[model samples]
Target: MPEQTTAAQTARADIPADGAGKPDAVVVRDALGVGIAVGLSGFAFGVTSAGSGLTVWQTCALSLLVFTGASQFALVGALAAGGNPLTAAAGAFFLGVRNAFYGLRLSQLLALPRVLRPFAAHWVIDETTAVSLAQPGRRAARIGFAVTGLSLYLLWNLTTLVGALGAEAIGDTDAWGLDAAGPAVFLALLAPMLKTGVDRAVAGLAVLLGLGLLPFLPAGVPVLLAALAAPAVLYVAGRRRGAGRGGTR
Candidate 1:
């Protein structure tokens, strides 16, 4: 009991003393800003999806329920191309499965309550992970991640409704550049989050693979291929590099 008490005291001491217990306004603002920016990508996705023949309900459902902009756009694009809904769903499912890995990492790091675990897992998306990891301080990461994720989720759903309804009367969505929104939004959202060589390598390889397979593969297949290939390549590369540096277990 004494040892446990001492350890608890030591753990508390590890928290920074200066303004450590207070909310970090700067980090919170930055986190919220990142979420808002990424949520714009969601709006862009809605616009593009609307242009691609998805109904307003479908766009809103994909944005609100699915909530992964990339997968939503991919699924919509596949459907627009007359691909099977099952095929589209499979592609979207695989791409979004990476979020489960994010949830695993976050569950260990956050140590959230069992009741809240489901909510946290749902919010563990790409932008949330990026914002959380980019936070400068330890506590800031946790608060920022949760706040940003919740904020983005709500705002994204609301704004997608706005975009979906407004897009119909805008006359040919492609003519208004709506069709280009998805790629542009993706680029903008990803550029700020990439902070490492491995991230860049994975992105570059995915892009290359996507381009290579797009012309030959069926709808949704190109991205699916790249998604599968990317992790394997990155894992092999990381292992090789670790071995070269004598850091492997």
Candidate 2:
């Protein structure tokens, strides 16, 4: 017990006092900013879906319930192309499966209150996960998660309504340059988080794989393909390290 206590004390000492390792404010700021920026892109979705034959109510429903940008876009786009609804739903389902992986990482990290976690699960998309994980501590992570999720949900729905109502006059949301804002903001936040060479490599590989597969594969398949690159790289790296150590032995 004494030895365990001493080890615990040493670990605590290693952590920098007052967040010398990570700043809390910066994480919160990034989360809020990213959420708003991404939420704004819902305007584009609203217009796009309306143009694609979705009613204003239907578009708003998707923004409210589906909540995931990529999957919602995939579903609408597929249906617009006259694809079967079940097939479209399946594609969207595959796209959303990535969030479950995010939830796995988060559940272990945040350890949120039971009352809050189920509600929080609805917000476990790309932006929230990125912002929360960027935080250095549990408190910051929870704040980041809640702020991003709430901000995105509210703003996305509002913008969706605006775009749906003004779909004809608004013309192309892409032409106004709103289309790229969310992804650009997300990438900017994510870039700083890729501190290690291995992390950068994994990100680069995922990007390459995802974009490369996008034109040929279905909408969600590219995301899944990109997801594979990180684990595959890690496995290969581990094997190489083992082989090098075995050779040295």
RMSD of each: 4.3, 4.6
Candidate 2: lDDT of 74? 71
**Residue-wise C-alpha lDDT for candidate 2, range 1-249, written one tens digit per residue:** 444556545544533223345567776687789888889888877887886788999999999988998778777766765666776787678768879999988876677779988888999998899887777767777778888999999999999999889888977654675444445655665687799878988998988997898688754556556777788889988999899999998
Badly placed stretches (over 4 Å) of model 1 are: 1-23, 136-138, 189-199, 231-249
**RMSD of model 1 against the true structure:** 4.3
Clashing pairs in 1: none
What does the lDDT read for residue 237 in candidate 1?
88
Per-model TM values vs. the true structure: 0.78, 0.71
Candidate 1 lDDT, 1-249, residue by residue in tens? 444566545554544323354468876887789788777666666776777788889888787678887778778878877777888888889888988888866654555679988767778888788776665445776787888888889888877877777776676665676556656666776797568877777888888888888788777777778876567777888788889889644
Error (Å) of candidate 2 at residue 226 is 4.4
Go through the candidates in order and give each one's C-alpha lDDT: 0.75, 0.78
Q: Which candidate has the highest lDDT of all? A: 2
